[model samples]
Target: MENNIHGKVVAITGASSGIGEATAIMLAAKGAKVVLGARRKARLEALVKRIRVDGGEAICLETDIRQHNDLLRLVSLARETYGRLDVMVNNAGIARLSRIDDIRVSEWEEMIDVNLKGTLYGIAAALPVFKEQGSGHIINIISTSGIKIVPLQGVYAGTKNAIRTIAEALRQESAGLYRVTGISPGLVNTEMPDHITNEAARSAVKERAAQIGVTPHAIAGVVAYAISQPDNVDVGDIVIRPSVQD
Candidate 1:
């Protein structure tokens, strides 16, 4: 844990578990006051307690990113509790992977709502504050599944690719007012795949996970590194995957 994160205020979506949880702990350990956002209140509360016991500052705002107002509350919590928001990590997402032929329209809709639109809502919540502050970071947790598209993962990849594209465009327009980054992680171990509706796809992903997946902490480190950079430096895109993922 570096002092680079000290005194900063970080709000993270999907803070209950996986990459989001890992980032919250890591950032808080480094002295950032973290605001946890997720639908799981118990989990968020537990993490807040853990951080506080470790001499770190933290607060939890139960959030479901599908709701725009929930995201607003999350942003407000960070500012109200810590007085400022230095970073908003759009780490909330769902991957209901399945073939287009399966016609899992409901799952597809959920993915779009949670992964793509949810991320947009996070941006909406934090953008104005970032603009007013004239200095802030928006870190989106994308995926490598989008980079090398495979069957059954089409829609999930599409959602991630959409965010990747959005991050790039945001960076170009931000100028000196803000920094935008897309963190594309590959096959890190987490509970993210529990939403998969297709039995075969779920089994395949589980098998792959048992094979070479890394810890979510690796991606958290990347998020920290991106935010730790100097004001003059902008880390636009970071793709982190297991060495044997291919």
Candidate 2:
């Protein structure tokens, strides 16, 4: 079988750790030239070194997805390094679980900025390149919080669902010029919980995740499956979670 992933240049945001990091390693091992972007330069450097040591082509750039220019640079790095960008994975996000009554305005803004605006910036950066090339794929790492709304995650889920709606709209508007996919993962063992400011909420989430959270590698595999499909086949929305999770 022809390997659709081989030789493809894939740029991934949030590549420093968690889903992005796992996805980077998985895709690189499959022969994709990966361009990694994240704010953690040290971690990105370490990831790049690990990929190289494993004999996979990879590079890292200090990117804060909150910055539109950073996203543009990330895309440019891919094109300049590999001649074309075959895929863009908007995998950077954050979750600050708090009740709606709490009114953590700053935290809400932060989520909007990172989870929602950051994704928009990624699309803005990649769409032009994809349009010019007449072919590209966008894979967004969303969360199942959007699917099953509960207390303390109202804003976070809102941001995710916003992306869900945008992804669908983008897919419809693509006109076969590009592909868009949204992958919503539920309760994976990642550092996302560490970002939660509410102490009690953080502890509860941490406990729950430690018990039922699947590995980020599982999510990475889903990403690989989406990207490995033939260009003509657009794998739309996917939701993966531990069966033990509610």
Candidate 3:
């Protein structure tokens, strides 16, 4: 029984920690060659080493998805190292929660840059290669915040929703040329909360995440499941979160 995951080349952004790191490890353990990209060079190197020590093939590059060329380099690295790329996981994101009236313009711009534009850059980098190869998978790590919009998460949700819309459109436009999937996670134990600028918001989010957030491994499992399916079967959208989450 072929699981359909082995021998594939997967390139993951935000691969230094949390869901990206967990996904890289899980997929590599399942026999996929992983190309890891993140801004933290040390973390990427450490992840690569751990993967290698586990008898899995892996490599790393310092990538900031905010830069289009960095994404190009990531995809290029995967192709150059492994002959072809099977998957592109655009998983880098940031969140700065505050009321709309708070008007954190800089934070809003940052989220737009990293979450929205960065994802577009990833798609741009991978689409041509996938088109040439006639097959590839693009997986975006979306957020449930987009689905259940609240007061403080207006901008964050907007960015995620924009990606959601784009992903759906891409899926429809693919005409079986490739696969597109958006995995929406509600709350996972990750460093995202630590990056929030608002002191109260950070504390509240951190405390709630501590209480109910699922481990990154759980989301990693979802990623693996999506990839393990036959190429003809495209898992379009998945929302995985703690069962108790509203």
Candidate 4:
């Protein structure tokens, strides 16, 4: 019933840039109080300053999602500052692409830690809060890489798809008090590609993204739309890709 976003408190992880930052701004513009978490303190602070200047309510916390404790601290901020949290957006993600032959076990571990375990940490922090609140929403930022099987993106895709399954299982267990949504975006324009170490693969993906990657704001629009729907309506899975993408 509280589908209206006005006055609701939303906590977002990885809010320094890309989809997380875009969602925070969009939600705030629509009247939601936003709490942002990311490792980049300067960027988070700047975004907060901008939000405040726009007459929006926002707070920034320096957080690294790799640590479960950081995620706990993030939700604690929402409750301490806003009295309650209505939504949690798990948007922190890292994609380091390499071929299986490269055997970049460390990079593989990094992806699992940030993309998969990071999301689980968000759930661990937010689920109890959601249950206590009686109504809350969890929006997870996955990727279309999971939906499309491609070389070099294997581990990245695995992490994303793992979260997708998590979202679905979480939804089934909600039992009417909570909402879990997985948003899959294809080739987004962001700094994620910077993490790729393989020169050829990095350049290839960058060129492809540059050619077809959509703005983060477009994905923000989708997030807003999903959260605005009536309580009876739950948008389970959302897939967004450029028109030119096969």
lDDT per residue (tens digit) for residues 1-246 in model 2:
336999999999999999999999999999999999999999999999999999999998999999999999999999888899989999999999989999899999999999999999999999999999999999999999999999999999999999999999999999989999999999999998998999999999999999999999999999999998998999999999999889
Off by over 4 Å in 4: 1-3
Which residue pairs clash in candidate 2? none
Model 1's TM-score against the true structure: 0.97
- TM-score per candidate: 0.97, 0.99, 0.99, 0.97
lDDT of 3: 0.95
Error of 2 at 157 (Å): 0.3
Per-residue alpha-carbon lDDT of candidate 3 for residues 1-246, written as tens digits (9 for 90 to 100): 238889999999999999999999999999999999999999999999999999999999999999999999999999999999989999999999999899999999999999999999999999999999999999999999999989899999999999999999999999989999999999898888999999999999999999999999999999999999999999999999999998
Worst 10 residues of 4 by lDDT: 1-10
Q: Give all candidate RMSDs, comma-separated.
A: 1.2, 0.8, 0.8, 1.4
Q: Show model 3 residue runs off by greater than 4 Å.
A: none
Residue 94 error, candidate 3, Å: 0.4
Per-residue lDDT value at 155 in model 3: 96
Consecutive 10-residue window with the lowest summed lDDT within model 2: 1-10
lDDT of 2: 0.95
